[model samples]
Target chain A: MTDRSQLPAIRQQVTELVLAGSPEHAEEAINETAEKFGDLAVVEVLGELEPQVASLHLSSFDGGKMSLATLLIPPKAWAESLAYFAATWDEDWIEDEPEVLAESLFAHIHGMVFGTDDEERRAELLNAALATDWGTTAFAVLFSTAAEEIIEIANDIHNLGAHRSGSTTSDHDVIPMALEIARTNEEGWDRILFEIFPDWRPGENELHAASEEESDDDLGDEEARESEFAMGRSTKELLLRLRKQVPSKAVAPAKKGARPSLGEDIFS
Target chain B: MNITSYTARTPQLVQALEALGQRADEQAAGILFDELCGITALVAKKFTNDRTAEGIHEAFHLTVGCISLAISQADIADTGEAKLSFLLQHGAEYVFQMGFRHIKELSALPYTAFVSDFDNDPFVQQRNLKAIFMEICSADPATTWSGDAVYQNEIVDRKRNQHIIDCGKWLRKHNAAGVVRDSEMDANAAITVAVLFALSGDGRIVARTAQRPLENLIAHIRDTKPDVDASWDKFLKKIPPEFQPLLRERMEQLRGTIVKKLYGKTKPKTLLTELQDHYIGSEQDIDYA
Candidate 1:
């Protein structure tokens, strides 16, 4: 790895490129530093200087489809920057190269900004990142944490309005990763349920019951009916099945300092 | 492996082609029929001079017809023209090969002509062509098939299964009357029945839920059929061995109740009178009964 002292200089160079309105150049500097120092060094630098790096925005002409503040700068620039940096690296680096280092670096930055302290913001960032097709490295970095952290992430994604339109990330993409983490621990289903039903709680059958009642009423209003129908029948059935699998006692109590449970609020 | 090994044996290919010939009665219309024509034309280009190519072409046509029929019969809501078109266009070669190998099994149905003759043939109604395709492909020698073909088939099978499971869940959620009235719902019911037959003894939990819809369907069949014994016999043959006895007992109970209600101690009415009296109730009312 590159010496720890060199990171400040590298960050300064990247920051200069960004200040010059050339994120493409900034990305190149970062990738070059990554190849020279290794992914860990690059991650450390990126993590420390995350706020400034994340704040760098591409020109509108550079296909600014994502949220302006997003880490996914234009692919062509990112690719060119990586290509230049990759040329300088040894051939040996190719064999065990982190293919999605760029995405991982961004994810780490996200982790730092939306640090573990604020559960809600952390989840929102994770979901938003996922929405933009975070590569395998990003998924590994974010989700390979503790089960409680994983559950919190799942709950935040499920409960928060994280599915920003035009994002490629889906619940389908997120679930299997969360489920894999959940499977490793005893309170796995709680995590799985948190991911599935945003407002899931022990012995709470409100959503299913409400859906049933809505279905029975005359569905003359097309928009309302369509909206109701959009809450997929199969999804409800799968939720019910998952609910059956979960023991009522397994419902995670409210976090010591966290907000009251959605279920508690509803039921009360 | 040599190119020859990749090519299917002549007999299997011929059998597949002959199966396609059986669907010649299907009128040329709709997206499926157009696809059948496109596939036939493409396959024909490969072996233009070979007389056997004609058979292969027919097989392609029949395979498409069978799928189209199966989707329509099963009331498969999601696997509409667009999905079929996408599959045919993207996985053209795999589909063609699959159709060539499995056309015979699909065409083995004795009533192919009868069913294909009508735009809305009840006899051809509600078959799970996706499951049939999966079963046919599953039996083929994996060594001879391309990885893309196998992977594509897996994707198709997964999507098809998910669709059926979704349909089953939807059916379970909604009332029979509200659901059965929709063409897609009816198709879903038929698909569920076809899936139940295909996946019998596979121990899928989703398959078990098919029982209620299947029971409702059997009742409908009983109401419609003039020869209940013949219809029941045909229906029972499709059911798995374990479920057959239970179904038979249920059917008998149903028949007995209908008989007692219709005949009573009064002079027995004609069969037509009984049919009119007992079976002429509204479709919605039948489920309640």
Candidate 2:
């Protein structure tokens, strides 16, 4: 890591770039840092700085329209981001890469999808997405924590399923490629799930208590279903089935935080 | 993983599920899954009632989730033509197959034609829905949070925090008949607390609470930001009189902590977060999607 003392200065500089300069300028600086110092440093600076940016929503609102949902992936940034997801569980990261990173990204009910649009309102809704920051500011808002599940969803869902009539992939194409590889990799699934659903993981105490409660015949079905959801057992089961169903040869996730594994294969 | 995970489906959907399995390329599976899964969110909202939004949300999520779980964990495909329009196309087809049956024009058209028509439907458009709902709430003289541009401004501007609070107020208020339904009263109360818990950044509001905590919170918010309180109208007023204190407590709790990622990382130590934690009247709206 760069000198720990220097971290705040880097954060302030990035925040200034995010607010004052074009998002491209801010992101370029972030990407440059990833190249020079690697993913961990940039992720660290971003995790600290995103909240600072969050504070400046009033300040960054206009530029953020362009910035929001715009992911700043420098090379294999997606793969490297996944690599650090597992690390967020480590005690050290809680200060910067907290566990709430794992919660299902769909907390707000309707935020899940854009209602279908027709020609007249299409431009209106399209402008709304941009105004809402489905661009660069969006990636900074959503992805800075390296929420793998949201990233995975964003790849296919087309801006969290807003279904803008002609929207395209927001992240580097390598993300979908990276997600496919990581999902197929045994360890990668663990890291991704660990990053996505920290509270629901099997070892959590509530599941154990519920499992003990399951012995009662009357409570059995309800508790079992609850336990299953809590443990992510059903998801694990479905994924196990998917392991057979999906045809990808498993490839490992890249090791460093925020690093994108931009293989020639990703390009092709 | 068991194909039987979803059963008793109509043959067409069943056939589609099986065909979906034919996707061997990581990219193809990912694209198909992303498309199917993304469209589900648009369709899922159709099924929401006051109470079961969470339950059905998970159900629709899992339905698409299991069929396409592999894509989330799999590979990316080579780029081709932008299929952005297909998302709305398929999304409309799926919702029509499930919803929009009531619209005469939509029902008469084939799925392709409905895509454009569906886009124009006010109910489906986010911008339209907010304006329509706000007009409903604002035009009604009987409702409480009425008579002001503040609510309209927030809704028009797409500031979701106030909109969420407004939803709780509306759910508690009387409907078209001007009476809160007995069946819905229970759901309304649950929504009140849920809204409180969500906005407050504390789960305790959802857990059963003693009475004193709430009264103190109402008093605190009233004292601290009395201007906001006048706007709040002890906004929980429409819910059961007994539950007002509970919702009030949450409205005052951690008012704008940005609950998901920022608070956890910086809440404890960073002065920046401390400043960020204060609630501005939500001139800024931050939706995760």
B115-191 per-residue lDDT for model 2 (tens digits): 13355465656444433322322221121222122322433443333334344444435332243322212232334
Instruction: Output the chain A TM-score of model 2.
Output: 0.25
Clashing pairs for model 1 are A131-A169, B73-B126, B74-B126, B74-B187, B75-B187
Off by over 4 Å in 2: A1-48, A52-268, B1-11, B25-28, B50-53, B58-289
What are the fnat scores of the candidates, in the order listed?
0.00, 0.00
iRMSD values, candidates in order: 25.7, 15.6
Q: Write the per-residue lDDT of candidate 1 for residues A132-246, one digit (tens) a residue.
A: 2222223332333222344444445445533421222344333444543333332433433433334545333222212445556665763454533222132233322322322
Lowest summed lDDT across 10 adjacent residues in model 2 chain B is found at B138-147
- Write model 2 residue lDDT over A47-126, tens digit each, in one string: 56553252232123222143321222211222222222222133333334332332221111012112222333323322
lDDT of 2 at B147: 15
TM-score of each: 0.20, 0.17
Off by over 4 Å in 1: A16-21, A55-175, A184-199, A203-268, B1-289
lDDT of 2 at A1: 54
What is the overall TM-score of model 1 with all chains considered together? 0.20
